[model samples]
Target chain A: MTFQVILVLFALFAITRTSRQYRKRKVSLYWFLLWTGLWALVIGIALYPTTADAIARFVGVERGADLALYLAVVLLAYLVFRLFVRQEETERSITQVVRQIAVQHPSKPDETH
Target chain B: MKTIALIPAYNEESRIAASVRDARSFVDGVVVVDDCSVDRTGEVARAAGAIVLRHVINRGQGAALQTATEYALDALNADALVHFDADGQMVAREIPMMLEPILSGEADVVLGSRFLGRATNMPFTRRMANRLARLFTLAISGIALTDTHNGFRALSRKAARELTVTLDRMAHASQILDLVKVRRLRYVERPVTITYSEETLAKSPSSFRAFGIVKDILKDKFFTRI
Candidate 1:
């Protein structure tokens, strides 16, 4: 019972933070909705363990906790891949800008040389 | 033809001057892209009669070469461009040999081949690495050449203008070969001597870094679009 209460409280806190970010315009409406839905699902599973078990059985998973772990792992891996691609893109942009600056102001050799 | 030698240097203050001086003799002008070296690479190159272009931050050799290529084609209006290493390893005397194919309109690009000529003081490990890189290049780009990553190359203005180096580091060498094959640019290899010193060997990328290059190239081939 205490563990269930803790999970619910954590989910509520995350939902609150997500809503705050949405209000501050830091997150788009699409992201806000996705996060809110995710937290609500978490709250529902925490409040009703039977619902998770039912869904897990339907998905051919033995345990609800195991299903959650698998989902989390896949999502984290996808997010990491996205971050790596984004970092490469950012680095390419920086190189392009630096190249332009170097090209514009060339330092010619002195006349004496 | 109006030829310009493009040298991409990073903290090569001691060797940049000699390389620039030697390259200036063969080409009409020498343009050195200083890759934000903490040392006085730019000053030394400039004093050696090279047009110095300074990068605000250190990008990499590939990025520096791309910047120099743009400057050579656009600003200098060069008819041909020679890619020379800032390190004293490459013999600037061979610039003409590299440029012959390009000048005669026989090939769009000319690559230097140490295997065909001489690799003075080259270590056994370096030779093995070069062979492996050649095979890798063949597998990836479907182009077979004696040397895959020689820094000494000559490109016609059209070749230089068409080929773009997107990889910003050691991988750029492989990327250049890939572009040559993809763009269907006529390329030939010329015998050139590379005298490797302890300093040059020390500065070269480690064997482990080859894995990184492979990974970068694979990612570029499959994940990213040029």
Candidate 2:
């Protein structure tokens, strides 16, 4: 019962944060809705454990916890891939800026050491 | 034609001066892109009569080459550009030979082929590694050539302006081949000698880094829009 209470509280806190981000224009409406829905689903599952069991059984998984773990792993992997792609784009942009600076103000050939 | 030799140098103070001097002999002008070297590479290259372009931060050899190409083509108004290495592995005397195809209007780009001429003092492991890299490049780019990664190359003004090196590292060599094929640029390979010293040999990328190049190329090929 204590664990359920903690999980519900955590989900509520996450929903509140997501709403605040949406209000501050930090997150898009689509993202805010998606996150709020995710937390709401989490709260629902925490409040009613049998819902997870029903969904897990429909998905051919034996345990609700195992289904959550699988989804978390897949989601984390996708996020990691997105971060890697973003990093590469950032590095390319940095190189472009550096190249522009280097080309614009080249050192004169006659400049002595 | 106003041929400018472009040398991409890092922390190569000891060899930059000599490389600049040698390359200066063959081309109308020498431009060295010092990729934020910690040593006195930029000063030495400038002293040796190369128009020095200093990167505020170390981008990489490929990025440096792109910078040099832009400067040579735009600022210097060069008719042709030669890509030379600062490590003294590539022979500066072969600049004209590489430029011949471009000068004669036979090809837009001319690549140096060490396999056709000689890679003197090349270690056995390095030779094997280069051979594997050659095969891998052929597989990826679908353009077969004797040497895929030789730094010695000459490009006409049009080719220099058109072919962009976006990879920004050793993978840029392979990316160049891919561009050559995709752009349908006329390219020819010329025999050029490479004299590898102990320092240059030590500076060569490890076999493990080959995997990184492969990964980068694959990502560029599929994940990114060219």
lDDT of 2 by residue, B1-226 (tens): 9999999999999999999999999999999999999999999999989999999998888899999999998899999999998988888888888999899999999999988997797778777888998899888899999988888889999998889999988889899888999899999999988887777767878767888888889988877673
At residue B4, give the lDDT of candidate 1. Answer: 98
Candidate 2 vs. true structure, TM-score = 0.94
Interface RMSD, prediction 1: 1.4
Tens digit of per-residue lDDT, candidate 1, span A30-92: 999998998899999999888898999999998888898999899899888888888889999
In model 2, the clashing pairs are none
Q: Which candidate leads in lDDT? A: 1
Each candidate's DockQ? 0.78, 0.80
Interface RMSD of each: 1.4, 1.1
Q: How accurate locally is residue A105 in candidate 1, as Cα lDDT from 0 to 100? A: 90
Instruction: Kindly provide the TM-score of model 1 when superposed on the true structure, using C-alpha atoms.
Output: 0.97
Q: lDDT (0-100) at residue B45 of candidate 2?
A: 93
